[model samples]
Target: MSLHDTSSEGRLQGRPQTGSQPAIALIDGNNFYASCEAVMDPSLLGRPLVVLSNNDGCIVSRSAEARRLGIAMGTPYFQVQRQLERLGVEVRSSNYALYADMSQRLMATLERWVEELEVYSIDEAFGLLSRREGEDLSSWGRQVRRAVRRELGLPVAVGLASTKVLAKLANRLAKTQPAHGHVFDLEAQADPTPWLEQVAIEDVWGIGRRLARWCRLRGVADARALRDMPSGELRQKCGVVGLRLQQELRGHRCLPLTLVPPPKQETCVSRSFSQPVRTADALRQALATYTVRAAEKLRRQHQRAGALSVFVRSNPFNGTSFYSNSATVTLAVPSNDTAVLLAAALPLAETLFRPCHPLQKAGVLLLQLQGEEQLQHHLLQPLPPEQQQRRAALMAVLDRLNRRYGSGTVRWAACGLQPAWAMRRERLSRAATTRLEAIPRVLAR
Candidate 1:
């Protein structure tokens, strides 16, 4: 059935929508990484907090207090070290394990109420609603928000709209406008012209800076302006994509929610070092570790890559003798098996290494990815039936054990004993929640 053609719906609370269906709700966690930290340690609440990216190089997540202090995303740690110390703002390394577990709990709570859902990111999801007469969407949204907060201790905002893009806009508004509560209902508003005018064209979902500039040149400066654009002219200017976005902005469903996120085309694992590496073996170890990590993800996704590439380079800081090199190889057979990947990967890493050169970073890239069932076995290099079965079983066992016991419970020999170039996480918080051994203790009075 077609959605409501007229924009004459009433406000959300206490009145049932006289429309065809309920609007899509975009529910997202607020300051997710920082919130995760604050939830675990109550002491960090209301204090300026920042979560650094890999290697503690830059600020990846910041709390509201941190923002008020002028800390921007991607600001290098070195640039604000003095300010952070002087202001007594706490810092933490990105603890992906804790964040992942909390995210699982958060989504589990949302899943109880929302059956048709799409997880857009680690901290964001979209849910479809079923409206009944006399039901209040605002009340329903608050219940969802409160449930997540009560169970998982994670705060979320909801934006309900006729389409996904509008829902995204509504979610943003929900965060900025907290007085009428953290739910924005576009479907309930008779006219959202005032709020639509405030949202810059650049802020709309699926519209990039380049597209915003293109739209601005045509006098479509805001969401309302873009929605009011002439369809034929927009089609001529930005092709069918812009036309569809225009239709979506005008409360039409042009895109459907993807319940399952698609697999990535290319998987690359790259990280900067805590300290400069001066040995070939160290660079080899880094490459081997990354290869194993990438292979784990590939196997988890039931995928295989036909080719692998490795690269190593000198720290750009020491400008005198800077050098970088890379090598790629096509595998005889595509397999997500760690042994198979490292067999092709470590040799390439050795070739890229240079004696006496300072290594700043090294990585592995898996390319030409395809599903495991679609593999083209090599006739010349075909493995014995028994040997192939054993390898597959071994890989499966490693995955299961690691998942049960935690990551790195099983790995290949080439990944090395000591990772000299690992990230610097000196200020990492206690892993009392995720790690069994690190669980907190109580002292009797």
Candidate 2:
């Protein structure tokens, strides 16, 4: 039977006796960042490796070997620098381009097996699956894991269940429990209570720390206990959201597959500088670069921003000397042009700059975004129809060149040729997949 079949006849054939039960399968890459690094360089496999966050400041991802070595996530690199070297652990700064490319490939591979897929994050996705009465979903999941491993050289855990929450729990078990062999199907189990009992209330999906505390206080310590809680009491205390979660845990689906994601309400481009920047020229350069990025994103989405905001901030950890300010500019006519965005954003950088404060971060935010189809033109617009078309054509050409060559193949003069305040990524890896020159070479011998 075809996995994509969803019609009544298709369901009848698949279900045979008990009727079809659609399942949600959550597939997540194991140690995604670390795994992405290993994919590009096979020598790192089975070795202790860690991927650091922006500026190489914090340990954001760790391989199984690294985790076993007691390297915790979010640990400052400075504190663990000595320990990592002593243990012969490899480290790499976040390579977003490589990771993003791998993620896209992973999603495309998954699309082949599932009826509908929702990309939840860079390393995780939810696939809607139709289970036949006698078909083995666990076996099907194994095929998925093997395919991803074979194609992308990335390890993944597959969790199939009647609901998203259970699928999430199943995915966690698939990762932590060696006996599961990296694929767990909650619906396949004759008795799911035992599995649910093994999951702590705090570890359950959608249950935050506060809610976990509340559950613990109420003597609900595990998924089983929470699932069996009185519906009225759960609803009264936690509202509809809580009730929906309980329903999902009880094998009832509440959240439907989001085949098409909703349009973004705002687009923001922000980053912390490698070093504190004090000069006005540096500040303007940073804001202009960020504005260009934000505008590009808007154009890609076929949306225009009605307003732009520029914010500058000093290190919040700098005690009483901390400074932060932002200014918003409303455009007469909505636009996604980099020049238009920079024109409005650069002036705000000058206005918000404080010479005494050493700014640590700056960003550009595009607000009140509207689709091109819904664009409202202003009566006193600065540009006429022909001029607007020319500007758009120029922006399109600029974007194409950048995409074909690489980011910043063509950029605004205001962005500065070599900004000292750029992000610090000393241990950065090559963008092997995205960039032509970064591709790995193999000797004929």
Question: Taking the candidates one at a time, how many backbone clashes does each contain?
Answer: 0, 0
- The C-alpha lDDT values of all candidates are 0.83, 0.89
Runs of candidate 1 with Cα error greater than 4 angstroms are: 1-19, 133-136, 316-318, 443-445
For candidate 1, report its TM-score. Answer: 0.91
Residue pairs with backbone atoms closer than 3 Å in model 1 (clashes): none
RMSD in angstroms, all models?
A: 5.1, 3.0
Encode model 1's per-residue lDDT on 356-413: one tens digit a residue. 7888888899998999777688999986769878988998899888876777777667
Per-candidate TM-scores read: 0.91, 0.95
- In candidate 2, where is summed lDDT lowest over 10 consecutive residues? 10-19
Show model 2 residue runs off by greater than 4 Å: 1-19
